[model samples]
Target: MIPLQRPPLPEELVERMSARGERLPQYRGGARELWRDSRTIRRELSAHLVAMAAGLSRCMYCGDSEGTSIDHFQPIAMAPQRAFDWLNHLWACAYCNSNQKRDLYPMDRDGLALLIDPTADEPADHLDLVLATGAYRPRTAKGSETIRIFGLDRPVLERGRAQAYVRCRSMLRDLARLAEHAERAEAGAVAHALTVQPFADVLYEMLRLRTAPRAALVFGAETVAGLNMLKDPRALRGPLHN
Candidate 1:
């Protein structure tokens, strides 16, 4: 998972959400009912979430399947007060929301949640991506819990990430070549391609490790050169860096 920035909601939308949250306790039908009742607000929220999501509205947790649900980061069952809070909502795929994560939320003794909030925390700070095998190596307790809760190392996801790593390397090489020829249009197209694919963490990890010791050995000299080419402002732009 990469760090996600939550965009500011309009005052009107924020007020709507706050009002709904305030009335959450009065809803005899509970959070689910109230959530379903706000179809218009939900639709608008979903649109903004998709706009902020990586690569064709991919799940914020897994970054694999298309995000089809608006999940409460802090489960409504556990934190009813945050039921309508925008900060507690996350764009997620059906599998991650219903199967993997569900309502299981683990917290530390200090009352801090163990689950990594992609919008609030940088995932790389807690979890390390093993590029060679496409598995997550936890660097902290939070990372371990996040991986287990989200099933980040599941076989399908691992396979996809492994494949993505190879594809990203090839794309980077193409991007470097295009940039060398001052083909701004082609380079921009390549940059766009790099950001739009699934398993975006693969590309992110590659870029992160570009300056690590023996990075050339890990990503190969040519791929490392390509990764370095990203420093050129004219070579890449837009969501690739964001």
Candidate 2:
């Protein structure tokens, strides 16, 4: 649901992969490693863990702090050929990655994949944001399996999301009050006040707990820049209802 940057493999790491016959065919001649070199696996996976953290800045499974490993949605041990596949990896909180989702993959009635790839799209689309409980429920069978397979409804994740949703709502109300009170000429002042206002830091810190508000998370210094990019100046100044 968030913009993520998966950095390219380092040259040194690539060289090491090439040193051994690691590059192999996958997913119909996918330009990937054929066999995983032990050392390369350690180095690449470690860095990937960092990049994954850097990507979402939190655990993909539960939106917690950086987890211990890069999750192979299709377990690397089982799908060793995909050990180096880019799209195959995901950031996993330690517990959910290992204890809960160990080697388990889900498929729908027709046996198609039924899991949410955080790297692909927002989880909110197929799932509803349950404000009362902060758990994701599939409006359909596929969604249910995704919720189960990815542990989207786990108590910890639900609580974190609930807290985040509350914070986001609180921030919106706070901004709305200020905007309503400020006169049109004081738009500049209102913007400044927004920075020092409560939860401003939380809003701007792009990479944070996933339980953090996904959209409002970008209310950073960059907001000023984004304001300029808006076609209508008035559009830049609106209450945070959304």
Candidate 3:
């Protein structure tokens, strides 16, 4: 999963939430079964959740890039308090978020969240996508439970992930080779280019698995590793001439 940048909320929007929080009755549900309430906080949050889901147009659960919907990674039945928790709300695709991740938040707190929080942290920090198996590994235990809860490996999701994984790894490999053989300036130039404009955007796509376009993972890891190494070539090369 790629790291996500949380968009800032406008002042007016924040005020609306604040007013609602202060005036509304306590949310009577948990994360699992809040959607059924049509007259309470659950109902109100459901509208926002649906709005967020509609806004994404892309699935938050599997990054399918199609058939997006508001997905509750944790069943609405189990954790009702999170019914309106903004963080708990995710825009998902019909397949991954709906069919696979039906109320499955590993009851064990051996880890944190099962689904990716496009707001809290970067997915790439803990998870790595394997192209062949369409699975992810938390480079940590916390990530493992997160993966299990969200069902990141549904057949459709896996295919999308695998496609992207292969593509990204391939790009990184090419960049790495250039870094090793190209002149210092040339290497730096390429690295800098990747960090900005198309390069950085492309990397972000690899980093954010929940939204990456399907069939884009035909790349490899060498280039990605190379870019990581090229971080400030002068700092790296300065030590070599001595």
Per-model TM-score versus the true fold? 0.94, 0.59, 0.52
* Candidate whose lDDT is highest: 1
**Per-residue alpha-carbon lDDT of candidate 3 for residues 155-174, written as tens digits (9 for 90 to 100):** 66666555654554654566
Evaluate residue 114 in candidate 1 and report its C-alpha lDDT on the 0 to 100 scale. Answer: 99
User: Which window of ten consecutive residues has the lowest lDDT sum in model 1?
Assistant: 233-242
Tell me the tens digit of each residue's lDDT in model 1 across 1-242. Answer: 99888999999999998888888888999987898899989999999899888888999999999999899999988988887888998999999999999998999999899999989999999999987789999999999999999999899999889889889889887877887788868888888877788988888888888899999887787788777766556445543463
Poorest 10 consecutive residues by lDDT, candidate 2 = 198-207
lDDT of 2 by residue, 82-142 (tens): 5656667777667878777888877667866676666675555566556546666677665
How well does candidate 2 match the true structure in TM-score terms?
0.59
What lDDT score goes with residue 229 in model 3? 57
As a whole number from 0 to 100, the lDDT of residue 127 in candidate 2 is: 60
The global Cα lDDT (0 to 1) of model 3 is: 0.50
Which residue segments of model 2 deviate by more than 4 Å? 1-7, 10-41, 52-56, 108-111, 173-242
| Candidate with more favorable, higher TM-score: 1 or 3 | 1
Regions more than 4 Å wrong, model 3: 21-56, 72-82, 107-115, 165-242
Please, what is the whole-model Cα lDDT of each candidate in the order they appear? 0.88, 0.53, 0.50
Q: Tell me, what's the RMSD of every candidate?
A: 1.6, 9.1, 9.7
